[model samples]
Every structure is written in structure tokens, then in C-alpha cells.
Target: MSRQELPGLPTEATMLRDFPWVVVRMRCHFCRRGGDARLAVLAAKHGPYVTMGRLVVEFMKECAWAPWNPTRRPQKYGMKCGGYCMDLRRPDPPDLPPGMQGLQLIEGGLSEKLPAAPAEFERRKRVGSDD
Candidate 1:
């Protein structure tokens, strides 16, 4: 079946809340192309009322994993070629939109589900801010 045909293939947290193993694809909000443009999904746990939380999706890329060079944002370098690289945050807090209500997702789609952001990178974000 095609990616989208997988029901929750390009699964949303909401979809995963119902179905476990699902395959889906997500398009890049920055890229305005079609086809494999959507190469990610947001998988979540299934439930009745509606389980809310961050959805963890899976992604597969054909690039050499690089260790944060402490000076690269990955995206800045063309050498860093790969799949999803951002978290799918909610558009609005409190509650999701009508369509988003049934679909648990925010941004980045499945590609958003990474092992974890580099600690150093996070540290930089709070360089001057108070904890």
C-alpha cells in the first residue's frame, strides 16, 4: 500500500494511540514539493477519550550519522543530508484544532521523533536565560 494508504501510515500521535505499528510520511513545511517529499510520520499510543502528549515517530535516512561538531547546526551544512530533523509541536495549546483533534501531531511530523536533541545544542539555547 502507498504511504498515505497505510491509514495511520503517516500516523499522528492520535492514530498511534489506536494503532501501534503504522507507516506514514510527512512533507516538509519548508519544501513545496510532492512525492516522497513526505518522508516521516507521528506515531502515538491508542486510546478512547484522547490521550494527549508528545508523539514519537520513526525515521530512516541514508546519511552518515554525525556527532555534533559543537559548531554546526547540521542544517547549516549541506554535508548533513538525512531525514526529519525537528519536533512536531502543537499549533495551539490547551486543545488541538478540529482536524488535529483526531490527529495528534504538531510539526516536523514523524521526522520530529529523534533519539534526542544534542545536549550541547540545548545548553546553547539557555546560555543567558535563567532555568
Candidate 2:
């Protein structure tokens, strides 16, 4: 029954049945990031080969939009729940701000800086667009 906690997360981890990990979803804190995640406390450091996956196919028929639930669906349809991120339950609430990428507050940060905006492209800027 040993339990551990991450700084902003709100769950106590528990050992899983077969994997070398623990499960913790104590009070369901939503990630500001887009998807849902489960806490898997690892005893040993695993490589990038180790990953957390979300199941989305089952909800394609039920979702109002994809949120993009069904990863199998074609993107042209633009179903919000029909994409890569779906199963975000457990310790996180379904409501939260979008997740952060790299060291950025949203989307791309300094790590992925683009080349200077072309003169032609800059002329097309929208009235309220901040790019």
C-alpha cells in the first residue's frame, strides 16, 4: 500500500497487477494538457519505448464530435473526439485547460521557433490573429 504523489497531481499511487508500475487516480485532477493520463510509478527508469496509450475507437459512435475520440477515423471529417486523445479519466477531471508543450505555456515555444514570417504571409495576418 505504499503511495507517492507528484507536485500538482492529486492521487495516491498503488501497485499494478502485472506491469512494473503503480496506479493513482485519487481525486481526479484534470491536466491542462489536452489528453488524459494515468499515473504509473516506475521502480526503474524505462526508455521512450514505454508509453501511455488512450483507447478511442469505442467512443466514435457516441461522441458529439471527435474531441476526436476514434483515432481510426479520417481527419477530413473533423470529429474532435475521433483523434489521438480520448480516454482521459482516472485521477484527472474531464475539465481543464489545454496541456503545455515542451517549456511553452501553449503549443510551440522557443524550442520550435519558425523562420521570419515572409513578407507575403505577413500581409495576410488576420485582424485578431497574434501569430
RMSD to true structure for each model, in Å: 20.7, 16.6
**Local accuracy of candidate 1 as per-residue lDDT tens digits, 23-107:** 3233233332212212123322223323222222122222233224445455654453234423233233223357765755466
TM-scores for candidates 1 onward, in order:
0.20, 0.18
lDDT of 2 by residue, 77-96 (tens): 55354333332223344444
Candidate 1 residues lying further than 4 Å off, grouped into runs, are 1-15, 18-58, 62-78, 85-87, 92-131
Question: What's the TM for model 2?
Answer: 0.18
lDDT of each: 0.35, 0.35
